[model samples]
Target: MTKFLLRWIASAASIYITAALFENVYITGFDAAMLAAVILGIANMIVKPIIVLFTLPINIVTLGLFTLVINGFVLKITAGLVSGFMINGLFTAILASVVLSIVHVVLSGILGVKKD
Candidate 1:
């Protein structure tokens, strides 16, 4: 429970940092970042798997590199769901996703939050 909350906060911070790094990825405020984090988490949990499954052949062909595109799509879906979180284009989303992934990993490590 405590770890979950810590991880959630870390995720929010990661979102905020990622938004700060990308011009086209806009997060209105910390509140927006928090909301986007939640939506992103849900989207990754639900939508991402379905997308990965559907794109399995291409993913295989790309040696799993296509997962980055799927991550971008998930980020776009998250932006669409959150009111104050906006990603301008698929290209920006892809770039932002890469940054977000790095930020999340670093934050998770710092928070000692083990992936489940």
Candidate 2:
């Protein structure tokens, strides 16, 4: 549970940084970013698994490139569900995914994945 929260915070930071670097993605404020992070966590928990299962063949075919799409979709969903957070377009979402992927990789390596 603690690890999950930490990862969500890291994800929120990554999203905030990515949006700062890119024009199309934006969160209204620091509190908005916090809200967006929790929304993103919830969306990922609910939607990501279904997407992965549905896209398993594509994931296999692309050798996991489709995971990026999944990440972007989750980000987009968070933006749509959260009023103060917005992702302007798919391209911005993809760029954000790139940012998030880097953050996720680094954090996962340092903190490790949850086995259970």
Candidate 3:
């Protein structure tokens, strides 16, 4: 439970940092970043798998690169659901998702938040 909270905070920080790194990805404040992180977590946990399953053929064709697009789609869904967390366009969302993944990894490692 404690680790989960720590990871959640780290994920929020990653979202904030990712937003800072990209002009098109706009997070109004840390509060918005936090909300966006939770929404993103939910989207990834539920929506991503369904989308991935539906796009498996394309994913195979792209050698798994389509996963990036799916990630972006999830981010877009998050933005739609969370106010003050806005992504300007699909392309920007895709790019932001990549950066977000890198930031999340680095932040998780720095915070010693291990995946279970």
Candidate 4:
């Protein structure tokens, strides 16, 4: 469970960084950020896959670009679920999702967490 905790911490850091860099991505504080990260991760793992599966044809039609929209939807849902985590708008959520994805990837690499 050490790796899981490490990844969770990395995700929280990514959320914090994304909030810092984007005006529309608002994280109230460190505790909020951590909770948001967990909520986002759970949403991504559960809701995101179902959404992506349903939107697969559209995803293929859009040459995989719709995945970003799926990610944004998950982020928006996360914001709605978490009281202190707020995304100003859909567009901002999309941008923040993209940034978060990048940050997560970098953190995973740095932390030596293999992507499977």
Global lDDT of each candidate: 0.93, 0.80, 0.92, 0.90
Candidate 1 lDDT by residue in tens digits, 1-116: 99889888999999999999998988899999988988899998899999999999999999999999999999999999899999999989998999998999999999899888
Candidate 2 ranges beyond 4 A from true positions:
1-8, 104-116
The best-first sequence of candidates by lDDT reads 1, 3, 4, 2
Regions more than 4 Å wrong, model 1: none
Expressed as tens digits, the lDDT of each residue in 1-116 for candidate 2 is 88777676666676677678788888877677778888887887889999999999999999998898888988998899888788888867977888876876676566765435
| Candidate 4 per-residue lDDT over residues 48-111, each given as its tens digit | 9999999999999999999999899899999999988999999899999999999989998899
Report how far off residue 39 is in candidate 3 (Å): 0.8
User: TM-score per candidate, in order?
Assistant: 0.96, 0.79, 0.97, 0.93
lDDT of 3 by residue, 1-116 (tens): 88888888998998899989998888889999888888899999999999999999999999999999999999999999999999999999999999989999999999898897
The candidate that achieves the highest TM-score relative to the unseen native structure: 3
Best by lDDT: 1
Give the local distance difference test score of model 1: 0.93
